[model samples]
Target: MQTMKLTIAGKGEGDDAPLVEDLIGQLGDFLGLLREVEDAVAEPGEENEIVWRVTGATRNSPLSIEITAFPKRHGMNIDQRERKVRAAAAHGLAEIKRAPARPDWFDDRALTKAGGIFGRVSNGLAATTIDFGNDLPPVVITSETARAAAANIVRIQKPVDRPYRELGSVEGYFEGFERDGFGRLVLRLRARLTNETAKCILQGQAAAAFEERSVGEVIERGRRLVVSGTLHHRGPGRLYQVDADRLQLLRNSGLPDVADITDPGFTGGLRSEDFLAGMRDAGSA
Candidate 1:
């Protein structure tokens, strides 16, 4: 068991939640670059701070590391403090046999001393989905890098080998259809892949590849659809995606057919539970 004590740089002035969150994320990235961590847990601490507990397995036994942050402390210098923590963690992990070798993309100085480090941290954290309904976002490191980088050696530095071309098709019920912020229509399908319901996205040119059917009719849930497209593996992790150009709606066969109506179900009822609850609470008040 190794314990590293590092004072969190920003805490307890005005609104420093964002700063604290960014630092925690950067620390996670640093740790991932150091060793092969198995599990990590984070919990709340006093003084508006957070406690990070990291655990990893070694050839001989399991090793654990705990990093505590004091958010209320003043004079928090991230560039210096981050480098110190990274050095300490690297040295500690080197004692273990199962520790992962440092990657080429890992530039401790570049990651720590770079300008707009906090901004990069913010974008990194936002790329992930967090369950903040129970409490604040858990400061846990599931993967090394937040955004897929071609240069990141610790996690996804090398590009995945690609075949000449891969063709794939899916016949499933239309789960949802929505336009993204950039006016790109995204279609989600619930199809059976490996005996489990796999949710796939049909976006970009594939979303409009079918001129016979409009995107409007495909929004209805339970509409079976057969979408065929070229598959390409991308990102540092090489996630597979389909560039669909052919989409057909099949009857009773669990495939999507063509869109007959130009504007299907354009007028739908808008119900608000908050308005109804307010009306009921008025009588009691």
Candidate 2:
């Protein structure tokens, strides 16, 4: 429920401004209530009951009223988690800021300590991938089979199996929903990288096993990696480094339909990397 109220310093007829300040702007005429204060959760089905109170009224010493508006319960159930994924592919973290917590699958990842929010948006990309079927193709798809129509095109990502969240630390997880031929919500269990910091870390590990790629590319690839963490109503989260290249596939073998991931809620910034043809070839243009 989107709830809010106001308390006047001295005895005076309180205008809607101070109250709406943290909420809506100038309502012009009609006073804005619920949605204005905190737009975190979206209004679900109907008007939700929100409790509130205002202090220092002229006729009354204090004013208490119940406001009703759309229920802002942005959450996902095993029956419907797709809404969150669609939001993630584009909005990313911003999408997370607009929902609520529902149920879970696994025993408990981090729910006891924290209350509502999740621990971390699983940064484990390897845990979630688009399996084009069969021996999964390489990260850089170059085969004629690379057509978008590949029958094996499966996006594997699910919600956290648990629901607990600690303060600072993040856990590895996956997308909070499921998909069918077009992706479906069957089971919603659920469920960073480096840079110059890489140079510092790799200073001595030159013998480090690396493929035929520039050090920068390797580091950039590593930087693209992330530590997945779920956001919880209790607090922020804990983080865990997820492998990058591993995200696209779980080995040469494509992820079977049985594969699932643990996605908590939000993800952290692993710093920007110079990836893709666009960034490196800027000089050619």
Candidate 3:
């Protein structure tokens, strides 16, 4: 088991409720995909490097969160428990909402150091979808740098093998992506590969390891580079691919909501009874 500790350096608002709720939710995630919890967001000091800790086991792939925030202002104080969990959710337990249209989504928008670090290192999260027309925009499946949606992020070099292993990666076309009724990222990716492009255009719909995984191969092109790809989706670790011919990015709408996949009781100001009641109301109303 690896004990992850972080010293969150920045201007903290020092709020504990959000922090605590975020933490409990993360711990539940560590326990299992099906585990559910409510309210873990924390409130630490405003503008201080808070020391955070999370005890996790490799077997369960989970951990407990802890933090100590120092007030940036004199006499400023915080609930230590709150500080810890907030740091965890913002940093560790929580997943980055990769708004690709924004360059800083991966860097600047990370709520905390732990979130950014984990987003960079954790496995899965190769690709997230963008729905241009469909109600479901797209959710970021993975954000790990090691395992990117497309193996070669930026297509720079010519192929050295029979079929190009990877083609150029596309991102940053919009200021921000939108989400629709189904909670999916709504966007489309179009690329003109240089001459004979990579044989495969790998796709990662979101961060679940190998979830929605596939490769697209370019067969024809004009003076403009040829483009080809596929839509991949996974369930229960099983693989499925949508045929490129019928697969249209335009069918989807906005982005996926973390709340949908996250534990219903998971915190975000949505209380247990209220959350359930809201869902019920949403269904009927």
For lDDT, the strongest prediction is: 1
TM-score of each: 0.26, 0.19, 0.19
Sort all candidates by TM-score, best to worst: 1, 3, 2
* After superposition, candidate 1 runs with Cα above 4 Å error: 1-165, 195-216, 233-240, 253-285
Tens digit of lDDT per residue, candidate 2, span 1-285?
222122211122553222333122212101221222121122222232322233223323332222223213544221112222222212321122233221121112211211111111011011111111132221221122222212111110233334344322221222222233543222111121100111111111221222233244332311221222222322112112212211221211224344435333222322235344445588688
Across 129-225, the per-residue lDDT of candidate 1 in tens digits comes to: 2111122222222223322221232332233554344677865666666566776555666442211133344554465553336556665666666
Off by over 4 Å in 2: 1-9, 12-38, 42-58, 71-258, 261-285
Task: Write model 3 residue lDDT over 173-208, tens digit each, in one string.
Answer: 111123446654333232211111112222342311
**What's the lDDT for residue 67 in model 2?**
24
lDDT values, one for every candidate: 0.39, 0.22, 0.28
The number of residue pairs in model 1 that clash at the backbone is: 10
The candidate 1 region of ten consecutive residues with least summed lDDT is 37-46
Report the C-alpha displacement of residue 125, candidate 1, in angstroms: 45
- Model 3, residue 191: what's the lDDT? 23
lDDT of 3: 0.28
